[model samples]
Target chain A: MEEVKVYGAWGSPPSHRVEIALKLKGVKYEFIEEDLKNKSEELLKYNPVHKKIPVLVHNGRPIAESLVILEYIDEIWKQCPLLPTDPYDRAQTRFWAKFIAEKITPAVRDAMLIPGEDAEKKTEELIELLHILEKEIKEKKFVGGNRNKYMDIVSLYVIHWIPILQEYSSKHVLTREKFPGIYDWIDQVLLDCGDIMENLPDKNKMFDVLRVIFGPRNNYKPT
Target chain B: MEEVKVYGAWGSPPSHRVEIALKLKGVKYEFIEEDLKNKSEELLKYNPVHKKIPVLVHNGRPIAESLVILEYIDEIWKQCPLLPTDPYDRAQTRFWAKFIAEKITPAVRDAMLIPGEDAEKKTEELIELLHILEKEIKEKKFVGGNRNKYMDIVSLYVIHWIPILQEYSSKHVLTREKFPGIYDWIDQVLLDCGDIMENLPDKNKMFDVLRVIFGPRNNYKPT
Candidate 1:
């Protein structure tokens, strides 16, 4: 097998998603931490289009976009398939994953990026979106149903990032009662994927990065 | 083989994408046109999450989101592969397809949705993105090289919609000189995928739809 490498940032959910996929696949590779402020030449060369973190370099070729990387990893490493074999099931998983990437991730960014009433408005929108997910996950143990799959991996961003955003904003957007299914799903995913839980960036480090990236807000000061 | 059905709108690029994929695979599907103004119960039932069009139903199971549907069509109907067989090549194809969906589509939407100075600003952004794509396509006969693949299907939006947008705005965002590779690629795609060309909604009808949806502007009065 050719050498595998991952270029990513510790605090980025997309990066973490790639790491989780790699870990689950039990693929040994080099982990290069990127200073997003000063991206490395290698990162620039590999992912010139987005120049974003979480570029998986397999052999000499590189794949960008966390979701795209996840798909690649699944395709390359057959052990513990991230996506379902059934075409319809795979479509559903991809649909939810795309939803998370396109809708949930951006909504969270908006909630954190904007301040004051605007942030609150965005938070409300985020909660509404979570409610939609809650309905979907209510009956299923995991996003792919009865097993962890691509949707579960992508949902990690929502599960992990939402609490950090709440802590930063001092506003509770995702409540246990409101999103019970989501909370249950998170607990199940964490219980199943111990590696992901263990490898997640420390909360304080996440907060520090968030403050640096988005700036501090009420009662949320940089440490 | 199970019954296949496509729920789509004529003027939607995403819808066209699904149509092209099905055609390329030679899959017979019942086409159900949904009125965007008043979406049918079936569309809502099938795609409750997004409540959007371009849903593919197979054996009474529904799959929403155009890109996801494209993948589903490719997977089930293996007669003509939409994605490359090699894992890495598939990853590259997916990366570009995602780039088109996430970055290029939204930029074009912004150009059309925003009015006056804002629209022009977005138009400039769109052109910059197109230039990036042009560089990628310059060396290759098609997006994925030597064949019409997923990237070409997604790029259909840029090829078809850019001219219509230029007509409406009276601003040539895409030109033969500026985007010769893209023009060549478009010609090739149209030449190869005659079904896509034949099934595409008329340009004037598309313009009428755009005017109705986006409203007439800059001396481009609604007919």
Candidate 2:
């Protein structure tokens, strides 16, 4: 008997990444919704170093960091392979996934969440990065090549969350005219994979949460 | 026919990581030393995104980022496995490796390289992180049990380069008394594995370079 549980928040991108990966891998997991304001003790105990959500606990052993969790899920399940079989291809997939996590994710946070003098500057930096991504996209239907794979799953935030994020925030950087490649990629992912829509948080509910989070208190930064 | 080329700098820990992994795997390769001050066209061509070193060019195809390159090497050359074969164990290995790369490495760069108002704060953070790592070290002779594996290779900076960095910079956070676990682990790695010392940069040479780099130009931030 295998026990799997995912501790994550609805609106958090990193948390969402884990859920999508598991679902794609066809691994049945218990989703434990965590309140961002008041985190559960298990969450803290599991991930003491960062104390962040999106932890995948397998057989009571907790693995924190969505990227780590995603790789773990892929390795264990092995049904629908997330990474490509080829060594070089796998490296490329890992590379882009990491690029999104490290570079783009932080840019999203800085641009949308924080309100300060550097807002415009941060937004510009994000635009510059997205354009770089646009070039990488370069007519590829999915980040992982054809079907939705690990890189594609990792990039869910860019397409789904970023639009919602743009709605709440002052900056509107990811436009169709500017990032046509990204827009096309998003459409293909959504069109081809109907199952992806299942676990994704309700848009209006996300907006409601974002409205409060990024509402009058534009400076309200979530941990 | 297989041709492997590594573009890396002498003093860089990330660069050294690639060399160590290659040597461990018994893969014969050519080392192309890059003047990080004036990065080559090939380096930029290979890694346009970051344009940083420690890129592994297998045949003609180039793969950048030390961590990504490490995985590539492990997958291709199966003789000496960098990661454990089991899924859960591999996850553990990757988790620790990522922790070292993302968390500890940045803290080190910030604390030593950039002399600023937050130097003290950064040093404290590094110490806190190291202590946390000390707890993890426990009684493990090597990061990879009984061998110098991927995590051990990644953590080379923490033990080898950090002392030299401390000598160059004012902050001496890593000490024997304060971090006995780390110190013991370091001694164990060096004593047991002699090949690790082969590719490691000369201490005196590194000091000379660091002394000039961190000299009067305390604000000299390298790109």
Candidate 3:
């Protein structure tokens, strides 16, 4: 087996996605925590394009971007497959993953990061997006029906990050009554991937980090 | 073989990406051209989420998003593989594909669509982005090296659309002198995939569509 190492930041949902895939595949690897404020030279070297965290180094070769890394992990480790085997099903899985990345994650991030009126608007948009996702996941126990697939891993932003955002803003973005399917799916994913679930950053710590990142709401400007 | 169909617009680079994949794989499929002014009901039904083209319908099921459809095509028809067999190589291919979709496409689109000062800024940004891509592809004949793959398909915007933007704006965003590697790549990809090249929309038609979509430059507001 090739030596594997993960460079990630705590409270990063994308990084958590990589961790979930690694844990699900039962791949033993070293974890190098990146101080996002003062990023490590290794992280920069591994991912110069984005200069972001959650880079998986396999036998010294680094792969960046969480979704791309997840696909690589799935292809290399056949046991406990992350994606469906069927071509159409795999496409569907990829579609949902892309959807989460494009729609869900950004909206959640904006809702959490932006201040004042823009944050409120982003929160509304986030809820609307979650409503659409609720319909898609209504029939399945997980995002990939019964199994916790790539989409579920991508959806860690919703399951883990939303609560932190809610606490920070003192607003309710996700509730059991409003998004029953998403709520259930969250529980199912946590139950299915307990080992990874156990290691997620604390909600209070996440809120604190977000507050520091965004600073006071009055002076915040969308970048 | 499953019944295959493509719902796409003539001037859409993403739509063209799907068409290229199907053509490269030697798959026979029906083509339904969408009118952007008034999208067909079939397109709306097939891709309700984004209501965007192109949607690749296999048998009865529909797959939206060009990159996802390309992956489906590659998986179903293995003769002309769009992704690398090696996991690391596959990851790199995916990384470039994502890079094109996220960074390159949007920058190019904004450079074309936005008006006046914003467009100038976007054009500068686009040129910078192309410089980076030039470095990535400097050593390879194509994005996949030796063959047209997913990144090459994703790069259709840069190959086909950039020239039209240059013609309209007369700003020379992607010149041979500045982007020699990209120039070589554009020629190589067109040569490698001549059939698809032959079917690309005329330059004037694309400019007209851009004009209509973005409206007059004076009135254009970046969305």
Report lDDT (CA) for all predictions: 0.81, 0.82, 0.79
Q: In CAPRI terms, where does candidate 2 land?
A: medium
- Candidate that would win on DockQ: 1
Clashes of each: 0, 0, 0
For each candidate in turn, the interface RMSD (Å) is 0.7, 0.9, 0.8
Ordered from best to worst DockQ, the candidate numbers read: 1, 3, 2
lDDT string for model 3 (B1-223, tens) is 6799999888788888898888888999999988877999889887867889999999988999888898888988899788777787788888888888889888877886564677678888887878778877875443346444776777777888878776665566788998898888788778876776788889877667777766544433333
TM-score of each: 0.93, 0.93, 0.91
For model 2, residues A69-93, the per-residue Cα lDDT tens digits are 8888888888988878888888878
Candidates 2 and 3, the one with greater TM-score: 2
Worst 10 residues of 1 chain B by lDDT: B139-148
> Which tens-of-lDDT digit does each residue in B2-55 have in candidate 2?
999999998899999999999999999999999988999999988878899989
Question: Per model, how much of the real contact set is kept?
Answer: 0.97, 0.78, 0.94
Summarize candidate 1's per-residue lDDT along A63-135 as a digit string, tens digits. Answer: 8988889999999999988888888778878888888888988887787666556766887888788888888
Q: What residue runs in model 3 are displaced by over 4 Å at the alpha carbon?
A: A139-146, A215-223, B139-146, B215-223
DockQ of each: 0.89, 0.77, 0.81
The DockQ of predicted model 2 stands at 0.77
